[model samples]
Each structure stands twice: as C-alpha cells, then as structure tokens.
Target chain A: MQALVIVAHGSHLNPDSSAPTHAHADTIRSTGAFDEVKTGFWKEEPSLREVLRTVESEEVFVIPLFVSEGYFTEQVIPRELRLDGWDVSAWDSDGLSADTATLVAEDTGQTVHYCGPVGTHEAMTDVLVRRAETVTGDPEVGDGFGLAVVGHGTERNENSAKAIEYHAERVRAMDRFEEVQALYMDEEPEVDDVTEYFESEDVVVVPLFIADGFHTQEDIPEDMGLTDDYRTGYDVPSEVDGHRIWYAGAVGTEGLMADVILERAADAGADIESAIATVREATRKTEADGEPGKTDTDREPRETDTDGETQAAGD
Target chain B: MTDVQATAVDVRDEQVDALLKRLGSNDGPIEFDGLSAATDADGYALSTPESGDHRGLSEAEFRAAATEDGVAPYVTNWHYWEETVGHRGRHRRAFLRRAEAADERSVPARYVDLDSGMETEWGEVVVTATLGENGDRRYEIRHADDVGAAEDELDGYDDPLDARQIATDDDRGRYRPLKSAPTLISGWIFENLGGRDAVETLDVLYPASVANWNLEREDELDVTHWRETAERQTGIYDIIEDLPREAVEWVAEACCVDSQCLKRREWQYDEGDDLAADNGAGAFPCREPCSLVVAAARKWTKLEEEETHTYEFELTPSEKEQVEAIVDAVADGRIDEIREADVYEGANRYRTRFLRAKRFDEDGSLSGTPTDPTDEN
Candidate 1:
C-alpha cells in the first residue's frame, strides 16, 4: 500500500497559509494516482505528531510543501514525524533531495521515504518564470522586464534563500529576462529595496513562498510600495517609486503545483503504480466476491490479497 | 530510486477481526452511532436499526466490505484510538462523535422528521448532520443566527480552513481576540463535510476547543492559577506578580467573567485561594490566564504604581450614580447595546456625550479637577 503525506506549515491565525495545501491536496486527489493522500500540518489539526496514526498504508512518501530546506524541513518535521532512524542533528549543507532523504521506522515497519520540499524541485524554476510573465500579461517579459524573486530569508538559516537563489540563477541563465535577482525579506538585498537593484523601469516581483500569508499578502506589498495599508490581492502594475511594479501571488498557489508535488513524489520513488494496483486488486476481489463495486465513497485502504483469510485467524 | 526498508503490517484486516470478535460475543447487536454489528449463524450481519435493513457477509467479505463505505474502518479505527492507543480525552471523543453522528437521530430518522434537522451548537456555530449514501453522514456548519437561512443566501465554503476567516472577526470585521465571543458574523456555511472533517473544521473554527473541553471532562485539565502564572512573567510584565490579592479579584472580574470571555474561569488566585469574582459559566474552561488578560494586567500593574490622590469632584447623587453606571456598562461590554436615543440610560452614547460636554472645562476633565495637580494643563 502507498500514501502521499504532504506536510505544510499551517497557521491557526491565518487560514491562507493552509489554503494552498488544501487546494493541492484536492487537485492531487482528483488524479487518483495514489492509494491515499493526506495532509499534515504544524499549526493545524491532524498535526505532524499524530498524522501517521491515520495512515493505514505501509509505504508512505512524506513531502514538505515548504519554500526550501531549513529548520522546519530539517529538524521540526523529522522530529514530529518520528523518523526513527534519522539523524536530524546532521544538517546537510547540500540541501535535501529525493535520493538522500529516506527514513525507515523500525517499530511500525512503516517506510517513510522523505521527499525534498516542493519549492526546491527542479520544476519550480519554470513556475517562478511563468508567474512573472503571467502576472505582467506579457509572454516576452524577459526582454525588458526586471524580475525579482522574493524569498522569506532569515540570518538564522542561510538555506532559506537557497531555493529562491537557485531559481534566480536558473532563470538568469535562460537569458530571457533583462535582469533576474533574488531578494530576501530579512537578509540583504531586501524586498524593501527591490526597485533599486533592477535597471529596468517595469519590475515584476514574484514571492517564492508556499502560501499567501503574512509575507506575501501584507509584508511584500508594503515593502515593495504597492500599498500603504496592509492587505492582500493587490492590483498589478501599481505605480511605485516612478516604476510599474507588477506583483504576482505566491508561486506555491499556482495550479501547476500539483504537477510539481507529483513529480517530487515520483522522483522519491513513491511506487504509485504498486499502490494503484493494490487498490485495483482490492476492488476486483470485492467485485468477484459478489460485493458491490467500488464507489467514490470507498476511500479506506483495503486488505491485501494474502491478508484477508490470515487476518480472521490471527488471534 | 529511493531505498526501501519496511515490514508489512495488515492493520485493516486486524481492525476487521477486532470488530468481528466484539460482534461475536455480543448479546444482541453492538450498536455504534448509526450502524449496528451483529453475529449470525452463517457469519456476521451489519445493519441500521432505524431502517431495519441488514446485510450478511463472510469474514473475508467483511474485510472487503471495510473499504466499501468506510464504516467498518471508521468504527474499528475509532475503537483502536480509544482502546489500544490509550487515547486521551475518551469522554470528549465520545461526546463529539455522538454529536457528529446527530445524537439519537439516524439518517432515516432525519428522513422521517425532514424539517427537524439533527443540529447541535458548538460555541456560536450550529452544526447540522445530513444523510448520505449507505449510512454515511455529511455535516453543514453555519453561524447559529443563520441556521435555517437559504443555502444561496450564505457564502458557501467546502474547505474547513475557511472557518478561520469567519471566526477571525465579528460582523464589523473587527478582529476578535477571543474566538468564542458572541459577535460571530452570519451569512456563511460550510456546505458539506464528512464526520472526521467536520470535527477538524470545528477545531479550526475554535482552536483546541474540543481537545481542551475533552481534557476538562477527563479531569486532566491542568489549570495554572493567576498568582502562579503571573509570577513566571519576565521583562516589563514582572510587575504583575506584585499585584495585591484583592486586586487579583479585580483582574478576574475585568477579564475572566462570561461577559468578557466565553471560556469559564477555572484558575483562581491560587490552588487553595479562590477569588471572590464570579467564575464564568461558559461551556469550556479557561485553564490558564490568556495572553490578552496578562497584557491588560501588565498595563493595570503600571497604572497601579502611580501615587493615589483623591481629587474632589462635586456632583449630585444622580450624576454620581450615572458615573458608576458608565463604568459598569463599559466593563460589561454593553456600551454598544445601549441605544443612542435612550438618554435615560446613563451609559447611552448621547447621554454620555452630553455629560462630557457639560462637566468638562476647556481641557477634558471632570468638574475642573486635574488628575495630577503637580502639572497644569
């Protein structure tokens, strides 16, 4: 059996933090790729601590829907998920990837193959670039527009800006945009001074954030001179400092994020085929046993072919 | 490909077997919220008592049936969490589960009394349970004010997370520091949610309310009293520890009462020393001093540091009573409830404005008496 558990930083105060997570879950659920798909949150219900108890599947793929590898992805999530054999103290400078992040629990026998965060995924670079073009309504935004990728960076963890830097470097290499620079919220080249670094008059700032919470909604807009009042969903191309500043929503809220999440799961060797097959076999067996065919209401994981009879005689 | 290391555990089959064992030994039928499990001569029979409809299946068929409608897993998993997991707040879970299942009314029971929807109130929100296919339950959550309001009339939301926005503010869009305040806005409904999802939605709506309420029911609510909580403060808030025993009762009366907050005041002056202030009669208990209360107390503590000087303000007996009435009205959060045209009411907006206009000198003061006579305005 297989399951995909997307762990996100949900907020009790700001529901928008968890909105993208729910949207992505719903989108992925419609695809019918895995036997089960569930979301665990840091600040919401079915928390990271007890989310594992709800999953009946043995082979689970846990993905962090974060911007990049940092304190939460490295320490808090691993500790909360109770990745039994993982050495969370070792902060790998190279950052998390599909190959280097798997952890196996010796007690529950549940193999949790940890996947890299969605933001650091190779596909995110394209999503960021597309956001700049889409928000400006110009397909050739790279020709004259100065694109600034904003990341919520802190001096505490340098790795928080790694994903934004990675995307910036990749987009810059494409030579499509006239200027592509990475800006941080807390660190130097701050989002507050976004227009000063760019040579172009029309600048497009896209927040490389997972959700449109405090940073994306209020802070970025205020810092970028889009609005004096703290608010969300600003009208693009607002004149700020004698320049047209086109702001886009957080990159994680993009609908294409469902593809990136699935890609991360597949890259981590989620074995979705086996999970899909297990459900198909369960449905076939139930139908052959003269039980009603599978329905949309049937979401629970079924017993494997070998366990049905053995289960009745176990105790 | 990622490396694989795992041992298989068939949890679903085991859950089915546990239910089977319970079914086999039962005198009649083991009844849960809506469905009933009974053992027959051939194998096992699961039925809805309200509908008088039953279905028989073999042990293997039962295992297969577990995944069909999720009822088998739902019952077994609930039992698993209750028994083997040593789950905390058993009473809370049971109470919430029964409430989610629509209490005594089943799906068919709702069909019989169609207009009389199976509804229950959690804080200010009204939850209505509706029947789905094959004994499945779907819940609708709305503000209690808009209980029977038309569906289209309200902004419908399917995501439970949207409750945060609804509960974040009052009708005037003012941020509600206290979540359970009676000022919840109407005209919104969470269309349909499953049992677990409904409970989860409520958890988002009223953060940790169910868990805390559960802890209270289990006699495991660890309450941190005012003195103990105040003593642990650091920085500027450290002055709160110096507040007198009599003043602590003022803090309780000001912040912890039902008028100020929805949570019942569980904390007292100390464990053995109870305050004279009336404990709030809210359904849920406040286990500790909230941050708002602590912040207010900090400000009050600073104000208490100032030397007291009784300044004389000559006024009639009715005017004195009116001044007392204004303080009482503001403390009880009833300033808005008093009408503007109701001049007879001492705390009425027009009456208060008239009092301010009549009593003050060029500077805003009562009967030309300065608070601090050392400085002239």
Candidate 2:
C-alpha cells in the first residue's frame, strides 16, 4: 500500500500553522484513500529525517505543503531525505533505481516519491479568487470594489513578485472589481504606499499568505495603521489624509484551502502510472545498451507518474 | 587584498615592551573603553607618543604593554582581557556552569492541574524545595504528581504550638531534638501559583493576608510568630483541599524521610531513592491498555459540551465535475479511470483519485457461495 506524507513547515510558537495540514490528513484518512496518511514537519516533532522511520508503507509519497518553491524545496528536503538524483521513470523489481541500487546496495527496499509543492497547482487560483470575493463580498469580480493582492516580496528573488503579479492579472481579467493591483510587503509599492494607487473608493486588501502569522497580525496592521477588525464588506474607514482603506484576512486561510490541497494530491496520483511506465522503458534501454555498470538514466525523476505511482530512475 | 602596505607599518620593539610592563604593573581593574580613548590620541603610544598613520596598534604593542608591569602577559590581546576579566569574567563562568548543571539534571515530569487560583478550569502546577540545616529535612512536592500529599502534609503542621518544654517524665522514652529545653521560632509559608489569571488572584491573596496579620498584632504577643503561624496554617489548609488523597499519604512519608535525612546532613539510600521511585514508577496510576477508558470518557464529555459547525462552500462547475468524476470512478470500482482524472486550468492544476475498496477474504475468495449454481451433465 502507498503512504501519503504531508510535510509542512510547522511552528513551535504558533499552533495555527499546522491546523490545515492536520485537517487535510483527517479528511483523507476518513475516506481511506491510502493505507496511511501521516504529517511531518520541518520544525515540530517527527521531523523530515524521521518521517520514513515512523511509517511502514512499501511506497511513500511526500507532498510539500509550502506556499512557494524556494530553499526548503530545493535544498533542505533533498538533503534530509538523502536523495541523490531524480528519475523521470519507474523503479526496477529491486525497488531501487539502477544508479541508486548500485550506490547503496543495502537499501531500505522501499520506493519513495516526492511531489512538488502544492502552491504550484493552478487550482490554488480558485482559493485566491474565493478569498478575494469573500474580502469584497462580490460573486463576480466587476460587481464590487477594487481588489488588492498582497504578497511577501524579497530582495533575493524577482520571480516571486512576477508570480504574484501573474495571479493578480488573472483575477483582474475576470472583471470582478472596479480595479485590481498587486502589492508587496518588502519590495517597492508596499501595502501602505500602494493603497492610495487604487482608483476605487473602497479597497479590499487580501494577504496572499499560507499562514496567518506575524505578518497578518502585527506587521500588516502596523503598516496599514489599522486598529479595527476588518472582514468581508466590513470596512474600517481611515480618515488619515482623506482616504478610505480596508483590509481582510490572509488568502491562504480561506475555507476551501483543504479542498485545493486534496485536488493537488489527486492530480499527482493520476500521473503516477505513466511515470511508472517511463521508468520501465528507461530500465530496459539501459540494459540493452550493453555498457558495463551503466545505470538507468533516461527517465527524469518526477514527483508522481500518470498513475500516481512514484517513477523510478529512467523512463 | 592589497599587499601589506610596507611603508604604512612600523616596528617598535622597545616601546611595545615598555607599554606591556606598565600594563602588567597596574593592579586596578582594567577598563578597555577608557584605555582605548587614551590610546586613540596617539596611534602607537606607550604613554603619549606621537601620532602616526599606522594601523592603531598591533598585537605586539598590546603584548608589550602587559609585560611593562610585574603582572604576566597572560592575555595576548589587551581588548579581550579587559572585556572578559574581573566581575564580567566571573559572571560569565557562573552562568555557563549553571546552564551545564541544569542540562545534567533529568527532564522533569510535567502535569496539568486546575486548582491554581487562575480563573481557568485547568492550570499547571510545579513544586521544588531544598533541604534545611538538617540533611533529612528536604521535602519537595511537584504539583503535577504530589498535590494531595503537599496539601495534607502542609496542613498537619499548620497549628501554632506553644514554646513549652516537654516534661522530663513524659518525654523519657521519646528521642526529641528539644528534649531538655525548648526554643521557639516563627515559621512562614510561601506558595507560588501560576495560571492565566493567577497574577490577579495572587495580588488579592497577598494583600489580604498582610492586612489581616497586621490587624491582629498586639502587645505581649510575638507578632512575628503569630503572623507566620497564621500564614502557614492558611496555606496548609489551601493545599490540603487542592491535593488528592493519595498525594496526602505520599507527602507524609516524604516529609518524615526528609526530616530524618536532613538531621544527618548525609543522604540515606532509602530516602534518596524514595523520590526517584515515586517519580519514575510509583506516582501515577498505570495508563496502558486501560488508557482507552479515559480517552472515551473525555471524548464523550467533549461531544456533549462542545459546539461544532458544519461549514460548506460552493464548488465551481469545473470543481464539481472533477469531484464527481473521481467519486464516480471509485464507486464503480474503476481504479484506472479514477487514477487518470486530472484537472488543468491555466496555472491551476489538480490531481484526483478514487479509492479502491478492500477485499476481506484471502485470494479474493467470496464469503458465501452463489445461491443459484447450474450444473450440466
């Protein structure tokens, strides 16, 4: 049976960050989709290194529950899991890729699959749009006030801002509001400075964050100079310099977030069969080449195959 | 990196050695900030030498300063010695030793209790104590495990006894510390309670006790003894009610053992292991196998008392279609159909799966034979 491991960047200080992951695990377990659905954390107990030891599934699929693909996804997780390379194909009967099998002969004999971060999924836009509508109280984008997409921009990556801007454009194209603008917390046109740039009389500020943490409570409020509770349609009128501004909870906290994660997991599973086929083909190709010690290297290592099985090295 | 600027650097072996000697002779506590200011005026001065553009002072200069005086140049760097020596050095070492000691100690058992004066229904309690002049007098009650014992033991000694000598004839058989003559001293009880609202309640309790004790003060009576005894009695009463019955017995035995061990100023095997055994194995009731009983009770209580909301959201047409396809495939026992379901809309992509039902019997055998089986001759 396959095991589904949801890895989250849990917090020791805040109990809310892990809530959604736990909720998703509970929902999946209730349906009995997989033999086991466990949660591991980068910060909390049952860390990434110990995740495999805690479970007994023959095949394991790790889904990173992060909002973005960065250091944690690229370096930290790979290092912790002790994965050397990726394969776009399926594994041999020995349950190891040709190369990995030779590198570590005394293996655990279990197939491990790692799924990309859930944030990369397009279904997440639904979650964002829903959060935007909730903030504006408008079913359609053009029916109500302007929408503002708030993102955490850093000096290190320009692409991060581009991704948020792309999502904002999609929301704007729906014609759901009087206007839609992209704003950042760190980079140029900060949340406060950009609030005035909106042409609409009523502004709805939506935080594009995965967790309602320090940024949502302290930094955002301090920057916005807001003291009153802000929600959908409940505007906190700020008379500072004769401008009206309002705010809303983080987009990640929308009610249907768990649904989006479930959808992504299912999508990853759908591609597993093809991924397994690729692995088999790659293995056969390597064997036919007649190269001594040559390993299966044709297939690329993907998070999941078309059939939802993790592909082995060589497709 | 540029080559070590040869012209800008200078070597003055004699001047540096003299400065080192002067620094060593100075017995007063070294102050770096003050010395840095003094040396800043002259780039490489022993005592007020001419200013130069060279890197203020090198390691050799500082070393020379220390040796100038009789004191050994134990410190190679003057700035480092000034910052770390004397009171600051002592304090740093003390803090490190304390941390090391704490790490060596065993991890304490944590317990939750609601008896603390916090308004909340549940709060945590922690207790720690040290032995008195008598080695056996050491007794501690951790609120987590020994709440009951703490209360009962504390209550037993709450009364204010008179400073009376036991009659020699009556005390003949007993071995008492105050056997021949008796002396009296005042005793006070100090209790620390913690919780969400403990601070507020503590404020009220402390002030009221102080005022009440002061009001009762009178001539000819030892006010200190009276106040101490009264406070101890009240504290004992409070703890007695807060602890469980089992805790009471444990505390009594612990107190007796503590008193005996304390008098000798040496640890007894039995007394030392009593606390260890209580904490490690004997304190809490066995919770294995039967722990389900407690869990069920808790769940039932929560279900009856708690309120839950069944929140729902409207799925978009595409979302509905995707969910239906996956659900239908699972229900139809078409694992491949369900596994192939994928939804891609712009950058929003979703993968779905419908679970396959499990078969109970080995080799996929049927539980019951078919009712209508036709045989051909």
Per-candidate interface DockQ score: 0.03, 0.01
Which residue runs of candidate 1 sit more than 4 Å off their true CA positions?
A1-127, A138-140, A151-167, A173-175, A184-196, A208-235, A238-243, A249-315, B1-97, B100-120, B125-169, B175-179, B186-201, B207-324, B355-377
Write the residue-wise lDDT of candidate 1 on A1-315 in tens digits. 688888887654555666788777766766678776778776554566545544556888888888777666766677667787677444344763433367765434578988767888877887787566556555445777888998877554555677778889988999988899999888888999887898888888888888765566667888887777653334567787777888886877765676677777877786554433333232121234333332221111211122111100111
Task: Give Cα-based local distance difference scores for all models.
Answer: 0.67, 0.39
* TM score of chain A per candidate: 0.80, 0.69
How high is the TM-score of chain A in model 2?
0.69
Instruction: Provide the TM-score for each candidate, comma-separated.
Output: 0.59, 0.36
Runs in model 2 lying further than 4 Å from the true structure: A86-109, A136-142, A228-246, A270-315, B1-377
DockQ of 2: 0.01
Question: On a 0 to 100 scale, what is the lDDT of residue B178 in model 2?
Answer: 17
Q: How far is candidate 2 from the true structure (C-alpha RMSD, Å)?
A: 32.8
lDDT per residue for candidate 2 within B1-377, as digits (tens), equals 11112112222344335344444464532333113212443343332111122235555555444343221111212322232222322222222222223223211100011111111110122223221121111122122333445353442221111111111112233222211111112122223321111221211111111111212221211122111212222211212223333432343233222221111111112222222212111111111111111222223433445455443334556556755765655544355432223334211123432111121134332222222233111
Q: Give lDDT tens digits, candidate 1, residues B1-377.
A: 11111111123555666667767664566665555677777676665432344467787766565544324424543343334432233433454455545345443334333233467777778888654432344678898889778999999998776776777667876656566566778899887776556766776665556656666776876677998878865444568898878778898887777666677888899999998998867766677776557667877887787887878888879888899999989877788899878889999888788788889887888888887887656
DockQ of 1: 0.03
- Considering summed lDDT, which 10 consecutive residues are worst modelled in model 1 chain A? A306-315
